[model samples]
Target: MELTSTKQRRAAALAIGAASVLLALFVDEPYVLLVAVAVICICIGWEAGLVAVASAGLLSSVILFSLESGAIGGAVRLAVFVVAALALWFVIKIFRTMSFYDRVYQGAGPNIADIPGLGWSAYPDGRLRFVNPAALEYVGVTADEMRRIMDGDDYHWTQFVHPDDVEASMARWHHNLETGEPVIDEQRVRRFDGTYRWFRDTAVASRDEHGRITGWYGQMEDIDDQKKAETALRERERELRLLVDTVPTMIWLMTPAGLPYYFNKRFLDWAGIDAVKEEPRGTRQFASHVELFHPDDRAAVKAVFEKSFARGEPLQHKGRLCRKDGKYRWIDSRFEPLRDEDGTILRWYGVNFDIDDEVRAQESLRLADERLARALRAASLSELSVSIAHELNQPLQAVVANAGAFQRWLTADPPNFNHASRVAQKIIRNADAAAQVVARIRALFSKTEGAPHAIDLNVVIREVCDLLGDTLTSSGVKLDLHLDPRLPATTADQVQMEQVVLNLVRNGIEAMQNVSINVRSLRIVSRHQNDGTVEVEVRDRGRGFSNPERIFEAFYTTKPDGMGMGLAICRSIIEAHYGRLWAENVETGGASITFSIPIRAADSIHTITAATADSRMGAFRD
Candidate 1:
């Protein structure tokens, strides 16, 4: 389509040239040809105009020669005409070029109006040459006013910049202009409404063929919304940072590789001035940070952290941390990984909570418990000694009475031999009985057993209940006996078996001390198992053991003043009789402690008793 337009323009120029030539030939007018040449230049460009001038000069020469003029005179006149046409072409070309450039410089061209944002141009000397219509409208100024402002001073644009930003903006602009570098800056500019909004101004120098800057063309982009968003984001970040710093607990942030990067205000304060300064950069590494833990805990804490980091797992560790005051306090530190959508670790966030008070309280309670246990043990030993003394007193008193009777018989006026012999026999019997009682006491203390005997567990339970009847009444506890009348007696140490029942019954009664009176019932059940064993169970309606298995451990107790030895001793006695003792929490309520011992035949009782005694002795030695 452009080719067609060019052809048409050339055709019009040729037609005008032809008409002018014909008019000149007929009217003999040179002024008409000059006018035609000027018309071609303006309409069809300078090349077409020059072609027309050449054709006119040749035709004028022909006319001069046909009129009987000399060839030299005709040639000279043609050359003068050609020279004049050439001069006219040069002047017209120069005028067109200047007019086009002037329109562009003034931002009067249609293309300049189509440009988005505020378009501008400046001379090489950093003087504003033109501001586009959009730019003039944005600044709320007319073309004439802007032109005046631009001409008024080199820093004329500073008037539109924010007051606080003017100095920095001017400095940057001048520096870039002097260095002939690209202009890039962000500053707040006044809008048409007299409100300042952020804008980014960028420009590059337009260089000529010699690499010298001719002008600077640039654009101003409205970045008000962007700047506002950035400012708001920064404000939110500041608030978050403040919150983290002011939190009571210590907080820290680390890289995925476990390098500490940030510590909150609490952490810095606790770590002291040296930490605040981040002196010795290595202190931020995992190993270096672990050094802050108590020497005894450093290795374990480091290992935990390293393992957690390598596996991208959360970690919790309780250890002592060295404070700035040179005191070590218990700190519970927890670390968790921040992960992305793909389950990749991005960072680690950690918190350290001071648990020194809780730890110290626990330690103090443990020490108090140990002291109480020792006191209870002493009291128990003293009680056992009194019981032993009471047992010996019976036998000793019997012996004294029998000895006085024998002495009286022997000292009688006439010696009563039969009566004296009978009295002496009684004294000997009492002495043997006293010896047996002493041996039994030794066996009990040594955790050894005497000869096995056939004894009904129901009888033992009844004896224990009778002994604790007063205690049960005082504590408001009811006793429920579930004895199997048909149950066969088991062969075991009668005394040790009685002791087991006694301990279990007491434990059950004590366990119910806190229970309501209506429900504070201690039940003792005895049954003959099909597996040739006798089972005894002590059940109570009370708070169950927290850890049923741990209750049987030596020195473990729930009561404030308990020695924690009752269950232990009971278990040992049962085990010595080749029995199994276990405890369990009842689903309905409370707990149950049960022991089962084998029912051996009467003939094997002696062998079993000897083996049991040996077992008990070995256990004690160990």
Candidate 2:
């Protein structure tokens, strides 16, 4: 279509040229021919117009000379006309090229106006050439106003930029212009509403074929919302960092693989500034901070940490950690993995809490317990000494009395030998009894009690009552014995059982010693329970026990000169026989101590024997 149009224009130009030439020849009007050339130059093209003007000049020159009159003058006139026409064509061609470029520039204006953000172009000398409509609108300025601002003494378009950012932005822009490098900066740009917003400004130099800068094309992108969001996020991170640093405990963060990346202020302060350089030492490995842990605890702590990290498990360990002062103190270090939604370990957050005080307190408490235990054992030994003295007193006194009687009988006129001999035998018997008591005590301590045998608890109680008969009578305490004749026999060490019954009976007698003679009565009761066990209760009308629960505890006694081992030993003996002993205050204003022994021991003969020995040992040791 374009080719067809060009051909038609050429045809029209040729026809007009022919008609103009004929008119010039016939009518002597050169102005008419010049009019046709002007039309071709304006409508068609310079090439076509030049052809037509040259053809008219040549044809008019030939026709005028052919008249044979004044040929030179006609030829000069035609040559001048041809030169003028040619000159006109050249001038018109220049004008047409300029006009076409002007139209193209005008067309680009609307396209630039349609851009979303601020856009502008600058000359190579850094002077503003054109500001797009968007840029002018954003700055609340017209093209003329912008031009005036650019031409001002300042001449950098800094008026529309935030004052605080102007200096730096301008410096960067000048540097880029000088280096012919791209301009890239972020700054607050003032808007049409007179409010400043963040924008990212970028520009690149447009270079010509020679690699020289021709102009600059740039764009300002609105980043106000994004910038605010980023600022807020940064502020939030700052606040969180502050909180982590200010907390009292030491804190640290690590990658999922257990490489330490961050440590809080407290950690740095506690571990010392050099701790920051202590990297590659992480949860799985402690090569760098090995000295941070006590030598005794470092290996164990490292093992625990490595295991926890390998399994992505939470860790907790208590051990000594070295402080900046080179002192070791207990620390409870705990670390837990921070996991994503799919349970992938993202980071490990950890803290170390100082537990030195608590650890020291616990050590002090342990020392105190040891001291108390030693004290208790010492007290038990003292009580056992007193108990031995008390046990031997009776037999020694009897031996002394019998010795005196034997002497008296021997000195009587014709001293009766038989009576003296009987008295001597009594003395020997008391001495034997004293030796037996000593031997029994020695065996009890050495865990060497004789084998257990089946014995009636009632019989044991009866024997104890007989042994304390004199004391009961002297104290004016009435003794009521309610023995269960049907009581079952239980297997136990006979001597130990005898000791238990004697202690209980003696305690009852002593309990009522300070009471009124009339009301001071002791009751000894025995029963055979349905549970295949024999039970005996010794009740006293003396002052009830102040502490029923602690009465069985070693070294606990109410009497001024009493050995606290009595009930403790008795309970141990009964328990050794598979029995239990307890004390309680009776409602009738008396204290009752009862013991029950299983009818048949559950243990073998050897076990019961060992148990009896252990029970006696425990009586003093406990």
TM-score of each: 0.57, 0.64
Measured with C-alpha atoms, the lDDT of residue 108 in candidate 1 is 36
> lDDT for every model?
0.77, 0.78
Tens-digit lDDT string for candidate 2 (295-354): 998798778887898999999899998888989999998999999999999999999999
Kindly give the stretch of ten consecutive residues in candidate 1 with the minimal lDDT sum: 613-622
Clashing pairs in 2: none
* 1-622 per-residue lDDT for model 1 (tens digits): 3422334656676788668867877877554576677767866566677787787677766676676358887677667777887888888878755654453345533576566788888777777777777888898987657755754656678899999999998888889888998999999989889999898999999898999988888899999999999999999999999999999999988888999878888998897635546744324667767788999998888888888999998999999998889899999999999999999888899999999999999999999987886776665565445545744664576678778889999889897989999878877866776787677667655645356778888888886686566578988988889899998987877666766787788788888888789899888899999998999999999999899988876557888976465576567667767789999999999999999999986667665544544544333222
Model 2 poorest ten-residue lDDT run: 100-109
Cα error of candidate 2 at position 418, Å: 17
Clash number for every model? 0, 0
**Following a full C-alpha superposition, what root-mean-square deviation does model 1 have from the true structure?**
13.4
